[model samples]
Target: MQEVLDALEAPPIDPEARIALQRYYVRCEMLRKVDKRYSEDGRSRITLLVRTIIESEGNENALVEPVLVAVNSVLRPGWTGKGLAFIEAFDGFPFVTTLETMRGLNLFKEENLGQYLGMVLHNRLLSLLGPPEALSAEKPKRKPARPLRRAA
Candidate 1:
């Protein structure tokens, strides 16, 4: 939403941090695209994996192990290898957006993780496709001044 975009554009943060955050946002959006293509059961399993990852609180090893298990157990047959590959490729860092999304959905109170995941995924997709001009903080353009008229 505009709120998130505005937050990204807010001043005073370290420029490196801002860039990193934007990159993470893009990565999550990419993951969301992959996630959205899953079948219903696969999506449910992915939601569970996301919950597990969030609960892991950035513990890389803790997140990876159980996710591997879930990938093998919950994903569609023969997709386990692909799922594992996806995890390996994308799960390098704990995404702040994922945590915020989990909190926003109140994952603890929700029985249906799939719906929440869908909401987050859709938001990310929208962000990815949002106004390209708004992606960065650019200084406002000043109109050119008219040539000074000669005194009549």
Candidate 2:
């Protein structure tokens, strides 16, 4: 994936974030190689990467953008399970805060990449925003009772 490589090469705004992104890029490349041979092993490796990204501190765009680009490669059409697993791996971490910066990036320009990622990250976003109750302080209205129907 030239896109992924380009993202990895792009310098991050923060020096520390850049280093972290570089380490992740190297690990991702290694995992991709292992994944080609082992096949089954790719799931766990991707999960590990997802966990590491979410657990990482700071909201630097430099770090978030490339990491997501690299990860998105594995989240293709045939990898629905991995996408779901990726969301599960969030485990209460508010990663969407960091991901917000990526919304305007070009990485999502790829076909359905943005939509696919949106689906994968939907659960995490919901968690961050909380239940519908939290979204609006107003009390929910109760439905009115319907008139009873006559039996034949």
Top model number, lDDT: 2
Q: What is the lDDT of residue 69 in candidate 1?
A: 35
CA lDDT, every prediction? 0.40, 0.45
Kindly provide the TM-score of model 2 when superposed on the true structure, using C-alpha atoms. Answer: 0.26
lDDT by residue (1-152, candidate 2, tens digit) is 22443433432334434454455456657776866543434334444444445533432232344445444443433333444544444445444543454555656554444355545555554454332232223466989989899998
Weakest 10 consecutive residues of candidate 1 by summed lDDT: 63-72
lDDT of 1: 0.40
Cα lDDT tens digits for candidate 1, 34-98: 87643344234434344333333353333322223322233333323344443342344344454
lDDT of 1 at 58: 52
Measured with C-alpha atoms, the lDDT of residue 144 in candidate 2 is: 94
Candidate 1, superposed: residue stretches over 4 Å from native? 1-74, 93-97, 105-109, 118-152
Candidate 1 TM-score over all chains jointly: 0.24
